[model samples]
Target: MAASLFLARRSLRLPFPRIVRTSKWCGVPALGVHTTAGRMNTNQQDFEKSQNDLKILKKDPGNDIKLKLYALFKQATQGSCNTPKPGMLDFVNKAKWDAWNSLGSLSKDEARKSYVELVNNLVSSEAPLKDSASLSTREQYDTLQVVSEDNITKIFLNRPEKKNAITLQMYEEIGLALDEAAKDDSVITVLTGYGDYFCSGNDLNNFTSIPPEGKEKMARDSAVILQAFVRKFIDFPKPLIAVINGPAVGISVTILGLFDLVYATDRATFHTPFSQLGQSPEGCSSYTFPRIMGLSKAVEVLLFNKLLTAHEACKLGLVTEVFTDGTFQKEVWERLRAFGELPKNSLAFSKQLIRETEKEKLHAVNVQECERLRERWLSEECMNAIIRFFQKKAKL
Candidate 1:
């Protein structure tokens, strides 16, 4: 929860191989800075090397399992650059498969990089793009068949006109999905989104429907959705990944901490901004955010209502990876398949062990903090402040 600076949703335009220089307030040099014009240039040679490696991966049948999986993921997730899905595995000759298997048996780093590259290729691919069609419709919601990288189950999110905000019913639907994923062994992962946003946290418009006394219940309900979602994610012995397409604020970004991996686009922005808006952190972020990032950084994010760029979040270890906007979904699958290739039980065991060690203590802390914050929120001063903030934003 590092307090984040505002991020413009524009595409990155970094100059290559140039150096930039800056002196910190404490006379510290940032780890990756080069001296030029206060900007760091991405090395062109590195980009070329990445490209060449990808080209070899795509062309060489030696790496076909990873390649075919990457291709399948690209097809499933709507990426442009992909090997055709029809007979994708069959397309790989035996020699190529042998080569890929042999390579897989080599260094773990090489295999991991190879996995990332395949995901990156699928994510950054630029042809044969598919469309996410709406598969079901309802009065206030529509389910979509989103582009996903390597999994069979397609994700569905509330695509109502109201900015795809979460509602009680929507939470129920989402909860059911997670439960289903937990039980279904074939479903290795689930990717979620809501229209242009990953999720806008809660639909505050629903607040008016609750009586004043019921506000506490509303807060509790919100917490339940968040808690259940995160708990299922943390305890779900399989790999779970979230591809954050855009502004994953409040609970959206918070819940991401529960997942095994998260991939976000350059356009993605994460924020809490809850304390500033008169609410406290939820989604167990009160605990998870602080652990993943230190308390001071988390305080900066939560207290200031800061917004962070995907790149900044990556640096803070919030986001697992970032991709350009166009390639975001494809890149997500790349990350997902890396998880898919591992032995399922081993992955589950590691995740379970991690959670088992910390669950009781952190969960209690989260509950206690949330309760205290909820009580504080009921104060007249907080109410007035919330009203005023909403009024000011409304006028704008």
Candidate 2:
């Protein structure tokens, strides 16, 4: 059993698409208007404009005066809604829980655009905003639109075409985003992915694109990317939560092993079929799976290539909780917010200590597992198995 486990772990490979590059942009396109150097100037202008508008509104609280002034401001901004988004509004409400009675008449569109621009500004500047602590934004792919919500401190993985299959660029962007989050005191927790489907795992198309000869290098490099993402999630003092909405396979399922809390929908599925596919789990599942789910359960999941439903995963201690697909988001929000509502600093410190102590050893184990996997991926035996599988699929 131990030998089989070792062989399976070594067979894992991280494939990258040679023909296509992973995008750094999360989901938004480049405006080309604000350069990184000039982002500060743009933000200062927006900040000043917002401040001036605030002063006028404070001077006159009367409905007639406030309405007239706000309307004019709206027109000047081309009638764009300045109202915060559902996620942003939630944060604002928390900050000013007592004062926030009802939302004022403001345009949602205006708020969204403004928020996007602000994020772009920070990305260009690579600097945190004055009122805001840290901000990082990047497009994950050319076609996909993955934006980090303003107040939620969320990182959305949004490549629907390939089911959010992670690429080299996506891994790099995620690593940088976490680094930025680490620097900011305000960012207490990091939430990942959109509704369902955290990540579909490795892009199989990559097998055909890259030089098959360099397959070993590609897998090793990809392992580095997964290592960075998992290391950050595991070591970061802040809470790391993964909202698994749909299918999570391969590296996706393994990466979840690092998250402190995981909430999956009833329809969600988690699996690591590397053995069936003739590979292994690169994100340190060799070590993490056995520790979290026990050796017997880990072997059942990794060696047999079994797909576990949300309920099944919960039974194996893989998932924290499961809810109906429709109500998953609402329930997750309520649960996370309750945690966020606690003394922010104290919560952060406690989370950090727990992660550091437990994850420190796993990090080393992950490095060892990944290095060995690269060697196996380049082995002739595994190569022949991969070739046979693909040839069969092509015949079908």
Query: Estimated TM-score per prediction?
Result: 0.60, 0.61
What is the per-residue lDDT of model 2 for residues 258-285, given as tens digits with 9 covering 90 to 100?
Answer: 7778888786888777765556665667
Which is the leading candidate under lDDT?
A: 2
**Candidate 1 per-residue lDDT over residues 189-298, each given as its tens digit:** 66666334666566554445665767677656645555565565556656677777666666667777777677887767887776655566666677777888888888
Worst 10 residues of 2 by lDDT: 1-10
Which ten-residue region of model 1 has the weakest summed lDDT? Answer: 2-11
lDDT values, one for every candidate: 0.52, 0.55
Candidate 2, residue 43: Cα displacement in angstroms equals 46
lDDT of 2 at 202: 55
RMSD of each: 17.3, 16.1
